[model samples]
Target: MTKSNNSATLNLQYGGGFRMSSVIPVIRKFNRFYTNVLGLLDQHLLETDFSLSEARVLFEIGHTDRCTAKMLIDKLRLDAGYLSRILKRFEEQDLIYRIQSDEDRRLYYLRLTDRGRDALAKLDARSDDQIRLMIGHLPEQAQRNIAKNMAAIENALSDDPQIRQEVRIRCDLKPGDVGSLIHLHGWIYAKECGYNHVFESYVCQTFVDFFKHYSPDKDRFWFAEAGDEIVGAIAIVGHPDRRAQLRWFIVHPEYRGLGLGKRLLQESLQYSKEKGFRRVFLETTEDQKTAIAMYERAGFRKIAEHENHLWGVHHIEQTYELQLP
Candidate 1:
């Protein structure tokens, strides 16, 4: 069969670049596979009378506080006319009711009737059963990995601030923490700065050196984790003469804007002060403008900088120092 004009236009738009064209097929394949896996192509959802969209509407009405049609439209990106018809059907079936607002006569709030709640509970049970059956044969670790990957996908695509996961900061170093931090540095720097594998080697070497003289009383490491994943990290490596050096300071790009970097920085600086360090300093490259701005704001002043041909690139290496009061 011949391709349609719309398909031809899409090919023209995306086919020019290898990177763009490659991603399109992968995403489309995932969309098709997921729809089949979830039985989303069925006329009704999970053997229920409600269509997928209608079931989602029921779920929101049952769970949301003071739900409204406008809220549904915004949350689901559903067309207004389509949602209106769904709500009307629910009303006719005695599954939902609306109450006019006391202060605003024109505004009405949607609430699930008793029958609606029962229907929603049934849908929820079936969904849980379906998911359990799908993943029941997998090992426990495999199940957890699937969950983590799903969360990562959601966090990557979601623009809603509320969807971002909560990150917790801890100073305890686990068995694989060092390796994970090194991986973060290597992967993030390579992607963000086009750094070669030499940069990863440098990071690995630093950890090796840090472990040689590892002093638990004087040194500390902070890891910002979301669920089981380490998203940011920093460390205070104690030195002679009451000095300390901040090292391995990195944040994953997906978790950067959530104040995690600032939290990690403050934790390290506070620990340095508690350990009676007179000065703390950190080294970074000139290409890290955002991190440099954060350092300056944290009372660190640029003390030294020089052109260095390290990390497979020729760039200005900078040192910023903060003095303890």
Candidate 2:
């Protein structure tokens, strides 16, 4: 949490041979797209003779209270000789001045001159203007979606855990909500269970069936949102005999231990009760140990099961029932 330890370090394990997922090409494509976007914006960096790196140095020097060359070296991880040259240039240009530290005369602190402040202000304005122009035509909601997705990508790849807080649940579907959930299901299951196209096809078919049997008043689909992104979901669909079927229950791998699964399960059960359902049931796989454990702890009894090879794996199909008073 402290700035000193904010940088992330990842640990990876490599096998002698491993099969890369089909998603790698798509990820590389997005990487190219994002790289281009940044390249476009970078065309308008600091207008002075300073390169972008030099401008960054100036900004950090201006902001850090007790800026020193050692701090800059550690923070930026730049070659000390190269940074000393940049600082020398700034001094020659009258943009920054150094003062001797009172306690340690050998160490000098950096400060921006009046001209340096003006230059920094101009650089900041230009950066903001470029971003505004880039996303100006997008609707507000679309802009938020872009921002949220970008943050999600950053968080997924980050070694440090994302800022934690209570996740929020919304019980309504938006335009692209179903599509995102389907994609999450496909991606997560493929990674976790070795599931392939057959599983995705089954999920698509379920969505189609859901549309055909949809009843708004008696059914609920809850999305667990955290950090402005959909991370988990569960649903309770009404059936005859005062029963409800829980469907499409999932929690993102990155957010599994945050109580999101339990919260979503609680919400689904509560909603089924509110809808006057006397019994609640769900179908899951034996491989879903965490979810099954939660169900058992919540008083769900396994009523039926069969063995079969589906979703690219040999797993048991289980049906769990919970009697609701």
**Best TM-score goes to which candidate?**
1
Q: Could you tell me the lDDT of residue 185 within candidate 1?
A: 89
> Which residue segments of model 1 deviate by more than 4 Å?
1-18, 40-46, 92-95, 99-105, 113-118, 240-242, 274-276
Evaluate model 1: give its lDDT: 0.88
| Model 2 Cα lDDT, one tens digit per residue, 86-185 | 9999999899999999999898999999999998898888878888999989999988888888777766765544354446789888888888888989
State the weakest 10-residue window (summed lDDT) of model 1.
38-47
Q: What TM-score does candidate 1 get on C-alpha atoms?
A: 0.82
- Error at 184, model 1, angstroms: 1.8
Question: Would you list the C-alpha lDDT of every candidate in the order shown?
Answer: 0.88, 0.84
Model 2, runs deviating above 4 Å: 1-130, 133-146, 157-168, 226-229
What's model 1's lDDT at 89? 96
Taking the tens digit of each residue's C-alpha lDDT, what string does model 1 give over 153-268? 88888877766757778888899999999899898988888888998999899989889999899999998887799988999999999999999999988887888888889889
